[model samples]
Target: MTAAAPRPLPEWTASAVSPLDAKLGLELLEVSPERAVGRAPVAGNTQPFGLWHGGASCVLAESLGSLAAHAHALTLDLVAVGVDLNATHHRSAREGWVTGTATALRLGRTLASYEVVLTGDDGQRLCTARLTCSLVPPRR
Candidate 1:
């Protein structure tokens, strides 16, 4: 028998909102099962020292990775929840926006993992992160 065709990626809607994302001013550029891209400004997300907060970088990383994994799970009529996340801060950003890109490392039936990279406006790597998510059936 022929295998079934894969389901298409879900389209993101303006009404689909995340309060934390909105609070952080995250602007999503692209999202799919393969990757997710987004950006957040450093102006308000910085620490008292005026440098970008490492937590902000982790937030961006987790957002991208989680979104990508969720997109992958949707294809199977499932949902994803982050189980573990880790990040390494390499540099700092004092101004402008930091862009984050998350690429899938593994997309499996029960788990998904993604590598997320955060870069400054000048393309300098600011942080590297990895997120692992568990996929399960959505609550009825």
Candidate 2:
């Protein structure tokens, strides 16, 4: 007997993958088990003070991290669900775009972890986040 091949991951599209992501203007540029990249505009995702909303950063971080974990989980015919997320906003962005890069910290049989960095268009670090997801069989 031979090991079965991993299932092909569905193509990630802003509108198709998540409604919140589409509303927040998030775009996934790349995705893999070890890494994922995404970006969102800061124009509408701002606080009352007109600065980039910290919550938006967290959303992007979790999205990328979860996507990467899901990619890994697919290899085992499992699904990934977010278990924990933590984010620290270091700076604020008033305009332009924010890019998030998620780097896998651990890819395991039961869980996956990633460190996500959100950067401004100027290449300045704006936020750092960590996310963990649990892998399990998909519910029928």
- Ten contiguous residues minimizing lDDT sum, candidate 2: 7-16
lDDT tens readout by residue for model 2, 62-99: 99999999889989999999999999889999999999
- Please give the distance, in angstroms, between residue 127's alpha carbon in candidate 2 and its true position after superposition: 0.5
Q: Model 1: what TM-score?
A: 0.90
lDDT of 1 by residue, 1-140 (tens): 99775444356635444787887899888788889888999999999999999999988899889889988998899998999999999999999999999999999999999999999999999999999999999999
lDDT of 2 at 14: 36
Q: What local distance difference test score does each model get?
A: 0.90, 0.90
lDDT of 1: 0.90
How well does candidate 2 score on lDDT at residue 124? 99
Give the Å error, residue 18, model 1: 1.3
